[model samples]
Target: MTSPLNTLPALEKTLQEVEILLAEAEGFDEDRKKLVVLNKAAFLLLVGKFEAYIENLVEEFVFAINSLELRAAHVPERLLAEHSVQIVKNVKDHLNNGKLEKVNSMFIDLSRYWAEIEPCNSLNISNKFSYGKHGEKELIKMFKRCGIESIFDEIVLYDPQEKYDSNEDSVLDIKGIFNSITNMRNNILHQDETPTLTVGNVKYYKNILVQLAECLEELLQKIISNADSKRQKEGMFDYVI
Candidate 1:
């Protein structure tokens, strides 16, 4: 598809995939293998959605730049192809380097691609996020607080002493939760063996995934709202970890 025509439809497709997977995940029974399958599927869908957002941004930028009376070198097409060859290259490099979050890598590419045209659009200098090592003391605290302490045999946190007090009103443990999930996922990933998922483990993982989704949704809402508010702020036109 042409760059301009491809942008919105691709994003819509990704968003649709996210919605479908999230809904399907909601109805998943407490089956270990099924949950694992669903979890991986949902993760892939999310990453695809994020990549689509990055691609759409690149495509839209190209369209906008092409309309302006700028030099050919100034157009995104000169540097970024319609098929996103540069982006795919970076993602490949990141995957080869053992970088886990391809979505963040794609976001970095988006920011860099945008900065070349509009520096103001390069909001975040880096897009990397770390939940730290699993089985750390803080993760233990998180599982304990979340009422699922025994599911994990080990905890590996980056900072053991980091304080993580969940608000009585909130069910999310943003810092520790992701770390715990990543740890479990790594065990299954790195071992080259099938994961032994007990009934308890399945339940715990399902709960963690749900909480993670809610936390992310809430955070995204807050960021979007803040951007809207700032766009209307004193003499400002418009504008995350």
Candidate 2:
């Protein structure tokens, strides 16, 4: 199926680059993965680009839904709640620090956000998306706020190799892979010891990210299309009898 997502193609290109790096590291031979640092670079690039793809995909979804001019009542309740997540976090942080002045100001801003938001206007999407420490938990939480429940279940991933019996019984472990990759990248970046690096692993991880993004794109497209369907000439629901 062709994806409507703008970011998926670019993400595919990044994964291709990771494969290119891996091939070069192996001296264009599949016999063995050589050059440990280059292989590590491939892994890091995969992790960084994968993270960016998820973030940009969310931003894309928000902007697409905003353009539809759908009534807020028609928008998913969790999505509306998501719009205030950042402000609420700020309020908590300020109160924790004993910054009463900042806390009061945040409350004022919160009130304004509630008062000024029009039912048929654009959603006030929060800018402070906290997927920086990328993992399964971060991805699931972010998607849940956007009204996607049990996102991992919603995604269907396939193994690139004919090696696995079925995608449903994937050995790659789709749900667990994101956190594993992020943790491995952190160890490689922060710790002094060199982590195990191989061309096969690099390519395997790249395919995993690509498959995840592809499924995510399909999921978001469906959501945005549904939102667009709710809009009419008046751009708000009239509750017609």
List model 2 lDDT by residue over 1-241, tens digit each. 2125577777877677787788788784454435787888889988888877877888887777766645665566678677766667778888998999998876665454345344434555643347345578778877886789879888767777756766456545678777788789878877855677777888878877888888888888888776666555345544322
TM-score per candidate: 0.33, 0.75
Local accuracy of candidate 1 as per-residue lDDT tens digits, 128-200: 1224433335433432221223323422222222345543444444446556555555655566444444434
- What lDDT does candidate 1 reach at residue 161? 27
Q: Model 2 clash tally? A: 0
Global Cα RMSD, each model: 14.7, 5.3
Error of 1 at 98 (Å): 32
Candidate number achieving the greatest TM-score relative to the actual structure: 2
Off by over 4 Å in 1: 1-177, 193-195, 235-241
What are the clash counts of all predictions, listed in order? Answer: 8, 0
Residue 114 in candidate 2, Cα distance off native in Å: 7.7
